[model samples]
Target: MRIRTRLLLLSLAVLLPAIVAAALGIGFVYAEERGINQRNLQETSRAMALAVDRELGTREILLKALASAPSLARGDLATFHEHARVIAEEREASILLSDENGRVLLNSRLPVGTALPALLPTAVQERRDAGPDVTIVSNLYRLPRNPDVPPSFALQVPVPHTARPHLYLAMTTPASQLQALFEQQRLPSDWHATIVDRQGVVVARSSDPAKFVGTHVRPELQDSMAAGEGMHPGMTLAGVASTAFFSRVPRSNWSFLVSVPDAELRRTGLWASALLGGMSLLLLALATLAALAVARRTAQPMEDLRHDAQQLGDGAPVQARSSGLLEVDAVNEALVGASERLRRASADLEHRVAEAVASFEQSQRALLQAQKLEALGRLTGGIAHDFNNVLQTLTTGLHAARLGSDDKVRRLLATCERAVTRGSELARQLMVFGRVQEVRVETFDLAQRLREVQPLLTGALPTDITFTQDVTPGLWPVTADPLQLELALLNLVMNARDAMPHGGRLRLRAGNSVGQSPAQDLPPGDYVAISLQDEGEGMNEEVLARALDPFFTTKSVGRGSGLGLPQAYGFARQSGGALVLRSQVGEGTTVTLVLPRAQVAPQEPAPAAPSGGLRGAGCVLLVEDDPLVRDTVRSGLEVSGFEVQTANDADEALRMLAGGHCVDVVLTDVVMPGSMNGVDLARLLAREHPRLRVVIATGYSDRSIDMPGVRTLAKPYALHQAVAALNEAMAG
Candidate 1:
């Protein structure tokens, strides 16, 4: 086949399916538009129904108030009639007093001596009989003597009378009052709204109130309403076709209907379909013409290119010419230059191949380094858990020994306690670096915290490298783990000191800032930016790019673990902020930690700890994986006046509990070697023995426990702290 003919056929193949899809999309849009319209109409109908019910409810309240009139209870019909008339005038309604048999004893719309006809509807009487205090709403009804008045409904409440308990007070509200509600809706002119009673008789019509009031709705609509509330197709009273939505008013059998003419609903869909079909046909015609034109213009050029390709393959020289198309012309020019370029390309290929091999080797080394770093992080976390256990054992043993020592021996024990505390801090930092510990966030003044840690920050730097602090006045408070923030600052100061081996001025500056650094990607909010600037040997771009990467360091191997900057970065990010670094080779490096400002005032400092050790009387179940820590803790608890039982792990604890070995409180280590951990055991006890208190003691845990009846005591705590934790848990 000719090229033009083939191209035209291809165009038809592609265009035909697109045209079909366009038609399907148009059909779906039409259906969806119809659904949206129906839903809107349903919502409007429901809102109007609620309005009707509220209007009726208001009138019912008025009737109940009238029924409790002192004059009515005293049988002073004249005085009661006067009061009812005044209320009726104020509410634009008519009040009537009726007997249980539906006889009107007094009518607010008539004189007191005038004889009144039976005005109570049977629905109201039946509803009243169902419950004496129940408010009843009757269907559209007419007063026998007032036939000229508009259609109205009755709201009645049974009178609470000592002697005449059967009496009822009623309020007659005209259907025209509902017309005001419809007007408030401000529906489109073509739409119609109506309120109908249980019998499907129109109580109020939005379009023609006088003509349709008290008239029965169409049989089709009546059937739709009988089926329940929803959208249906029907004709308006004027014989115009419409899509109708109906919803029943709450607390009554009456329903409200909203209708839009079918012409209005289908107009948009019909026009869209016609317009889309016309556009699709025009597009197909234009595409076919373009395809034929393109094929004609490129056919000779394609032939020439094929001949040149054959020549090049045979190592023969080939001529080039313009082919009108840019792409085709480029291919022709390439053919003319192919012979000379192929010789040069062969030499360049070897060089490119060597570079590719070098790049691949570099990438392999990087991948290996990354894997090693990841393994190290996991190993660090595991080692930290055991390290905490050892620290706890030493802490508990020292406290137990110091309980009866003299002042000289107690002073030595206090020094040992300080060493244990330092060890615990080291273990916690390892857990934080490994990303296994949760941040304990609290609100605190950043400026105050910086001042408190200034001594430590200054002491870490060399005397030659002067340290200075600049804090903005009235610094906004920030929320974060205060202890972690202090550690991060210390790490930054150390890094600054390392950067300036020759000793240069170092400054720590803090101030309030908005999210001004686009590179940091901090969220747009108020933040406290604390930056440490050093006049040291700054890093180049390559080194700075990987500065926050774990285990990526430039210092000598033994001098740095490459975790300081990364840990600070992790802390900033985990606290809902960002770490930003600015550095150059010669000038200096400035590292900034942007922390989110606290939304509330800083909490007041906690009260001082009690002076003496806490003593409690109870059988305590101790669960620990470390035998030395368990024995030490049990001895300490025994000295505090408690019977202690020891278990190796969570499984043994559960077994002991299952065997009915009663204990008032369970003190378990969070990180334990068993099928379950301390958190799991605490949750099980919470479910099975809700009254039992649980105290979870741990140096560090990857998981957090926030359960009732559970208290957490940090590792390396003194004996007094453990006893206090137990006492608090038991009391709680």
Candidate 2:
């Protein structure tokens, strides 16, 4: 076929399908737009409903606060009435006090000595009496004495009194107060919003609220209101057709409805489709004309280009010639330079290929190193878990044995307990290195914490190396896991000590920092920078670059695991800070930890320790997968004046509970070999036996238990500490 004929046919084929696609897309766009409008309606309804509920909640809070006044509690009605009147005026609501017989004792809206009617609704009284002490919201009603006023509702809170058990404190809020909630939404002028109580009586409206207040919704919306929340085609109370969306208010039976006129919705879709279709048709016509012009202009130029390509492929030099068209003329000029460019490209191909291979090999080596480090972290995490369990067993056994031992034997047991504590610390370090440790952040004075750890830091260094400390007088408090911070500091100090084999001075300094550190890519913020500087042979550029990389070290294999600096770096970053290192080959090395400053002040000192005595007495169910830990914990609890039941795992614990093995508290391990872990077991117990207390014990730092009202005891806890936790849980 001729090129012009082909181009004309191609344009027809493409344009025909495009027109059909545009037609189809109009339907999709219409549906999408309609869905977006529906979602907007629903969201607006929800927002308005939330606002209404928030207003009601505020009134209920005020009434409850007023009910607790000392004047009311002491039967001083004159003083209480004065206070209630002030509060009612401030809140723009009326406060009423009623006796058990539904007779008003005091009404903030009326004079103190005026005779009041028994105005409490029967439903409000019955609901409050049937359920626990709670706030009850009455349906819309008019005051019996003042029927001319707007419709209102009451928020009733029961007051605990010695003589009058059913004394009620009620706040009367005009339904019009809810109209403000609708106005806050700023809905389109064409849109309408309504709020209806449980019985479908209109309490408030965004449009003509005064006319519609206290009126029942139209029959067309009765079924939608029954469904609680949904979208449906309906008519507004004024008889205007609309697409309405309704959402039920939280903590109440009321519903909020938002509606847009059907005419407006349909008009919007029609206008968008009409405009889109018009634009598409115009573009299609222009494209057809452009295609025809191009086909006529390029047909001869394409022939010339084909001949030039054949000459170049046959290794013959071709003479350049212009073809009038700019693109064809450019192609002719390119043929003149093609031979030289190809020659140069071929000459440099080998060098480029070698460089690409070198880059790929380096990437492959780095990837392999990353994979090895990842596998090492997983192995380390598992080892840490089992090691902590062993330490817990040892610690528990030492505590259990020291109870009745003589002075000498008790002293020996104390030494063993210290060793167990050290082992636990080592396990925690492994977990930290594996990035599996849970950090409990708290605000603490860094200088005070450093002073507390001075003994440990000084003990870790050799006597030949002198240690010096210089802390800023008013250092900023920082937020971090205090234990982790201590561990990081100890690791840095140890690294400094190792660097100075020969006697050298090591200085520790802490001060506040601000702004950015470009070298570390530190963000601009307030920080507490703690630096450890040493006078020793420092790291070279290459060593410094990989200093924080996991398992990269210069020390002998048995001497170091190479996780010290890396762990410190991870801790700093996790605490929203950065670690910075500045070093040279000969001039000493300085490692600085730039920790974000705490926004809150440091907490007060903890209370004094409880007396050293076992103070628990309850039946305890002990669940543990490890036999040694289970036995040690059981013996300790039994010695603390408790009857103990044993279960190997969650499944066994469930069976024991099902078989009517009564226990006051269930102390279980979090991670176990079972269908359910300790957290799951605790939740199940909570649902099935809510009155029972639960205490979870786990050595794995990464497990986060979010069960409120349940106690958690870290593994390797002393007998007294476990007893204290159990006691607290039971009391709670």
Candidate 3:
């Protein structure tokens, strides 16, 4: 409130905050300089290490590729010169090959007859003894024929020589090559590098090392060599606190030590800190001026807004000259417009809300219609399944009737039978298209099963066509509906073969592919992929896009079914997978069947032979709610000579079993009777008569059955097919 006090407070606010910022800024600069120096040192060291590692890694790959040369694999030297020269050029290292006894067979630089050093390194010797490879560092300085460059180091990569029992691959890189590498790297000013031998002799030095080549560290520190205690900061040169670091050269016992001087680190850090401090003060002055200007400018607009708000609260009209500031003018204009709009919009919102409510009701009705359509699709699927069962029954009885008739009548009936069979197949395909058929799981090794189907795959192709199998090894086991998988593959392979009437390469490849993310056009997961590629007439992009839709095909009608891909698509969907098509107009088409990798594998095959006499003569209880189905099954059993009793559902079947009646088998349908289905009835009957065989029959083959011991049969069964199941049921 007082002028003196206000001045004091303002001074404190300005200078106090300024001083705090300066102190923090200066401290951070010092910390940052130290961090930068350390980072530079670490990064330089890592770069050097990585450089060495890169050379080593590249050398290893070069050595391996050289060892696998045509001359090496075939063991003939007539073509060896070009191969050896090519390897030398690629690796940038001289290559020398020798017999197990160290007699030089081939050298990149010298003639073929040149002799090598007699004493081979232990690494090379042992490698020659081992089966695959002999890789190690050997001091090549002792070898006379070794290059005249300084003390040399060589990597002896020995692999089996084709012509002889013991042969080797010696890849030599001169020590000077590495020293030159160390020499060329520009380290900090006053920073030097040294590489010492195992005996502490300085083998390589960046600076003039004539004075200290063979010198040893202090004996006290030398005693801790095994424990690595010679790495502390110590006096190496005047005024330089040299920090020593060490690492043993990989694949060797020799240790390498590098000394980084603290004076060099501190010299850069201190200078940087001073420079940073000067900059901090200058920035603080500028920032203080900017902050003051911003605060004054911000407060002016807020002050005007506050005055307007007060007048508006008191119900007074505001009149002021428009500021030249565009933002300020815009804010004032917005406030005026908002006030007027609020009054008018309040009355208008009710009418708009009523319109919105009507729109919402219309949208709700459309959604209901869509939901009903979806529900109708589901209902049609259920009815189609029951109708399919009736069709199967009609076909089965016709076949049985034809079997008992004369040969000429049988032939005529066969023509009608073909029509019926085709219709049944069409119905089955349609049901799949409509999403009625679900998954029916049978345990089989997918890779082996695919291999077995190779014959069928090629059979569809022309005689000149060549089909190749590109199955990846270590293919994981898969659990899925085997029948559906076969059908899907059948469709793809048949399509591929049909495309190439003149015969081209038809490849069926299976492997693990990481599926793309949904955002990337394919859904993400590990997929077991079976790709069928044909070097044939590929589809255009327009046709390919709609390839999986029902009745979308390029083939001439009557020659092919348009449902091949659609059926495959349905099968893939039912089996928790997807069917994808990729094609180029002139290039080949590839059909990829991607199934999710199964976590639970298929069951192993039974070790023992399955028991014979699956048939048994016993009083059997057949539970069928459908009278026609019951009568047909009873007639088939009467011909097969097994006494049969009847029931309508699970409860009736259970009642008869519990009534102390003699019954050996409880045959029932799964989706039937009371609260208890056939699965539940079977479970109860299993415990009731542990010896009685329980058989479950279903019209819905794709329906899942989780009960352990029930033998499942899909209907409209023939007398023989039903007999086989009954025999297996009656056996137990």
Q: Please list the C-alpha lDDT of all candidates, in the order they appear.
A: 0.79, 0.79, 0.63
Which pairs in model 2 have colliding backbones?
none
Per-residue C-alpha lDDT of model 1 across residues 585-676, encoded as one tens digit per residue: 89999999988889999987664332225677889999998665776677777867889999999899988989999799999988776688
Best by TM-score: 1
- lDDT by residue (573-667, candidate 3, tens digit) is 77677777889977989888777778777788554321101234667788877554565556446545679899988888778777887987777
Q: Which window of 10 residues has the lowest lDDT sum in candidate 1?
A: 605-614
Model 2's alpha-carbon lDDT is 0.79
Stretches of candidate 2 off by over 4 Å are: 1-15, 120-132, 161-164, 266-271, 284-732
TM-score of each model, paired residue for residue = 0.38, 0.37, 0.29
Q: What is the per-residue lDDT of model 2 for residues 215-296, given as tens digits with 9 covering 90 to 100?
A: 9987778677788778879788898999888888775678888888998877767778888888888988899899889888
Cα RMSD of all models vs. native, in order, equals: 26.2, 32.0, 29.6
lDDT of 1 at 580: 88
> TM-score order of candidates, best first?
1, 2, 3
